[model samples]
Target: MVKATINNFESLALSGKTLGSISYATRKSVGRKSETDVAQVNLNESLETFSIQPQSGFDFSTSMGTKLKLVNARLVATEARSNGRTSVVQGVQGSLLPVSDPTVDEYDEAEYDMVFVTGKNRKPVARVRSKDAFDSQDLVLFGSDVLYKTDNRNQVIIEDDEAQKSGYRLNFVQSKIKDDEIGHLISIIISVDEYERLAPSLKPSQKYVPQGLRVAFVGNETTNWTLYADTVVPLTENNKQAVKVDSKPNSNTAVKADEKDMKK
Candidate 1:
């Protein structure tokens, strides 16, 4: 059995230096459209905020996890007008810096004074006052994160036929099960494609268990059991039809369906 821990697990992020889990996301559409249009033909914009908490004893200066240190960081709200215009409104102002950088002399002056704003809102999103030094009081910082349009297609390449066949194979086994432990050892097998498809619909913190799905084991309970689907076809109707036609007893249905049905 393989051992796994959260230490090496990588988390998914939309873009650019995520501090922590995304706490909030807001989308707005603002623009003018003609009478024939169903809705306003405006620019689609989104504003996301991430809660960044400094690790207790982790030194930001030496750690790779901590990307940027912002002192005198402020939260601002901006809105796009329907008349092709935008406005910025300042909200709150405070510092969120690295604990090691109590004095502002560690980082370059220009880097510390830089402020970035999202295209949707023209407000001062975050201020990078110092890279290394931060006040102890500024333990938590809210970063106004921005999301940009990205291609969502999977770009994996299966080098050979064998590799392609094994690309979607996934196995499950309990870790740290001792030889003498009198416990039921359960294992589940699934395809990577199916897992990816079902993962988005599941809760963020949900776990997949064979028992939860009411799966039963056959044969000797002492031995490990594995289950897998034959093959996963693409969810599109065209792909389903292709698979069905390929698996049919006879492959002579080249004629139109109406002609074949009439003959039958």
Candidate 2:
């Protein structure tokens, strides 16, 4: 039996402020518990032994030559050996022992995979992969635990906070447009690699466009519709095109006397 205290109107039951204590009781009931169980039991023997202090903010684990942060860390890949063994590689961070290691519990990997610590709003920030191969989108994201690497041998590791906060960013190359899909003029940005991704469908042209510039869509006519960025639009009799201008048409020109007579 242990003696404890509860203050500040905080609950002391199994579902309340005492998780470790309840976990201990649960482990004792289950017969499978950690070696730290005895120390944890002694700590709970007195209320003072367990501090009920409130968390100030995000706290990272950086002990025993290991640096693990819930927000910034990502699980990269899990490998299965021929001997029926396995280990997980944490991108930018080292590997962890097999999830079934005697020192670690089965739920340990799941718990650390994407969990935010206390005072961290309990958000999942990363993704985990257990295989070597994955798709193109997975390569751009840090959450994907893939083994794919660039020519430089750098596996892309995205910042979870940045990905959560902002939209997906990519490095694109000049890609061609599908002639059939090119309808009324809208705008598009493409990279060369993106063009290749759409190959066999996209129509080929002689010249390549500069990067990061917006290209307006033109109709079925292929030759005269496309032009360089700085080219001037010529208002001609046969070719009537809508031009984007700085100012709106003058409102005074819209009022007509014939229109007023029609209203009466």
Candidate 3:
């Protein structure tokens, strides 16, 4: 019953100072120009410029420096080189800010940002923070919105006892996120390790009814995060009436398939 937080790597806020002009994302790799059905918006934060691809069609009276928020955003990897598809964010919706700065509290309670890093940094990433990452979260997958194949590729590193998969991220969300309440679609880059550590006990959530997968994070602040897997919590007839359940629908947002020649 916990509300998902925004600190997860799969969710992000773009253009700290308001960034861009929205335009159609097109591809010329399929032997002809084609529309991606998503808009490409470039934004800036702290002087860092980034281009984000969000599902288009929502009208925003966007001008320069308009703070934007994108949900269900993640990077997708492709094994082939001819798909002409860039790593995209599965943004259900992108809205203007005042949606709240994703942090410890509502308003600007705390700040969050990301970048590609290569170093043994301080505090195991966010251990240096006053609030631990995902301290206020209890993720549960109600079901997949659309579970099908696509043109994305994944690479998992398997070692002696475990493995880490980081090709497509698992995106979770609140059953009914309010339009103005700053709902966040958390995309956890969970590895196999998270699945190993957490056990399912059927401790019901106050925010979400027990229906699909009771998810958990595998790591801590010290080691950052590892696996993101579902726990086994079976519902019974005696208590089934008390819980609002969701059908175990298949789910998968990113599925980059093998790339090939100029034909599908």
Candidate 4:
């Protein structure tokens, strides 16, 4: 048996308060049992919230509204390789360790891949790939086929938490993957400008395909689930057109002249 793995962020630390109840969900399929315990926490640096799963049987005694800092947390992607060229993605593996820390925000802060951590002017302390390959973003986001969209004036955390910026967020499933058929889904956050520009075309009456900025663990590397584009760029119309043009067969290519006639 061969092992396949990838590590992008070696360390992930965040200080935030619990947003909602931490619940454990049980998912059963065929002969397997899976734990779907997820924690919804709000970032202390801002009001942005994200759901992350924790280790099994973790202590959840920490009640809501308590200041917590994620400790010993990292993002990893795994795959189980069998015979040559035969393997399957094992999904993202890692756990969030939110330890109570009341003074987490007391320290001057820095940003890494849009995630805030304690300390001032702090750069990336650890990375999986070379500095050029991985800096802040080690995740790729691509989306198509709009499932749902939020209010355009809603606030989303793309950069530092600041007031007065408004935009929209939507869940876009990859055009190639069916949601019911697979568990792959991507959430895209768009700037207000992008939203306004695409609003007319996005009417319910119009046929629209949306692609935007979203973070997702991808099997970009064979050995590990590491390496993502520097930024999550929404797919564009020109790009779509280019694909269609490129995929079509060339009509100008000359064909062989009458091979059967020559044989006769």
Candidate 5:
């Protein structure tokens, strides 16, 4: 027989006390009852060999093994493989719980491709593709506000800085507009390569625009619009032309407006 001292009252069988004693039979029987029922005899022997002691908290131990403490309200076992053999080993959960791995949550290149278009068009114009496909009636945003809809077909592409360096290309269609109707100014955000190729013909007076500046193109005209390094001047409520100011500052001039106050 083995004697164990209970230190915690959490167990319903040993409640309302700081310490108590429980006896267990450790010896195995040498008779027919024991031979016919091996499982029960082994279970009783294991229960007697292991002891539970409570100090600051409960600690469980077998006579020949190290004590194990409960973690996250449960006991966990971990295994590692090496040289075609698997072995249970101690792990970080006992020391560092709730760990995070950044690589596990990172997006793959295929996922990035799903969000943008990759192709060619007849015209030399640049194109912007969104990770999401938009319908003609769907509203598209330039920065923080909606600038136009897919129906206009003049929206520009905005590529991430890292993505531009990878030589990804987009497709743009030539604008078709009637000569009688007033032409609308369409703006696009593009990579540096696309901007350099089209900049010469567009003849934007200012060559150095802000990193994410939008290049505005006149409807049907294709290559006639001013390029300024100033903040992106959004189109007016009528979507006819960009709202600008006449003042020029050091060659980098743009029509200015209270961007915050402008409505979508």
Candidate 6:
């Protein structure tokens, strides 16, 4: 997996580092924020301030699946650091001075300071790396402990197609599951295109799309599943053209007050 820290765009723009390099550096620095980390500790009351919302009614199961991979733009590197070096030079008296710098000859590793933001009002709970321009996704699980603290029903699924592209495998995890076999795994199958579409729907200030894409679990059972498109297409009557109405005559339609109106 490619690594990218917060302030990724600025780091890429000013310092000229690739996105992959930044991600690599950020993942190594620190543990991501937990749900409790963002919680507002109740000082006055012994009980923690808590609230709950009824989950919207929807079937949350899916079939085993695979899809095409997304493309990521590599930031252009402007200033490249030399790797740590080892060199020898003669002193004033022609005495040889051996110098050793372990990483001096290699590219200098990029550094980033982090910014922490608590999830509030439905925003994602996450730990972010910050910079002058924007905050990048360091780690994000969810908004509340109730979401993450529970036994996660998420599963990661990876698939391969032999006929289409040789040696290319598509990876996508089921978002919400019924009987999860694998332990909770972060779903990383979001395509770059999906990221672009979902980004705007989130708050204007929101920068990170942690999952890259959102997949709606569209069926009542795992076998009856279909991956909807990236955009949220509302279920409007126009799209329901094929939806069947009961052919059995209803009294309202059959027993029209005026026979002439029904005849037309």
lDDT of 1 at 140: 19
Q: After superposition, how far is residue 84 of candidate 1 from its true place, in Å?
A: 86
lDDT of 3 by residue, 20-126 (tens): 23332221211123333333444333443343434454444455455455433333211222366433222222332333646222223122222211121111111
**Which has the better lDDT: candidate 1, or candidate 5?**
1
lDDT (tens digit, per residue) of candidate 2 on 1-264: 222110001111111111222111111111123111111111223332211111123112212222111112222222223344433211112212222334422233322211111111211222222111111111111110111112233323346532211111122112222223222111122223333344443322212222211111121212111111111122333322222321222222211111011111
* Least well predicted 10-residue stretch by lDDT in candidate 2: 5-14
What is the RMSD, in Å, between candidate 1 and the native fold over all Cα? 23.9
Q: Pick the winner on lDDT between candidates 1 and 4.
A: 4
Off by over 4 Å in 4: 1-32, 44-48, 55-57, 78-216, 220-264
> Candidate 2, 91: how far from true, in Å?
8.1
- Put the candidates in TM-score order, highest first: 4, 3, 1, 5, 2, 6
lDDT of each: 0.25, 0.20, 0.30, 0.31, 0.22, 0.19
Please give, for residues 32-93, the per-residue lDDT of candidate 6 as tens digits: 22111111112123332211111123111211121111111111112112244322210000
TM-score of each: 0.17, 0.14, 0.25, 0.27, 0.15, 0.14
In candidate 3, how many Å is residue 189 off?
A: 3.8
Kindly report the root-mean-square deviation of model 6 from the true structure over all alpha carbons.
27.3
Using alpha carbons, what is the TM-score of model 4?
0.27
Could you give candidate 5's per-residue lDDT for residues 88-182 as a string of tens digits?
42111111111131222122222211111111111111112111221111122222212222122433334562211211112211123222223
Ten contiguous residues minimizing lDDT sum, candidate 6? 22-31
lDDT of 4 by residue, 119-175 (tens): 212212221212211321212333222112213443222434443333333333334
Off by over 4 Å in 1: 1-162, 165-185, 201-224, 229-264
User: Highest lDDT: which candidate?
Assistant: 4
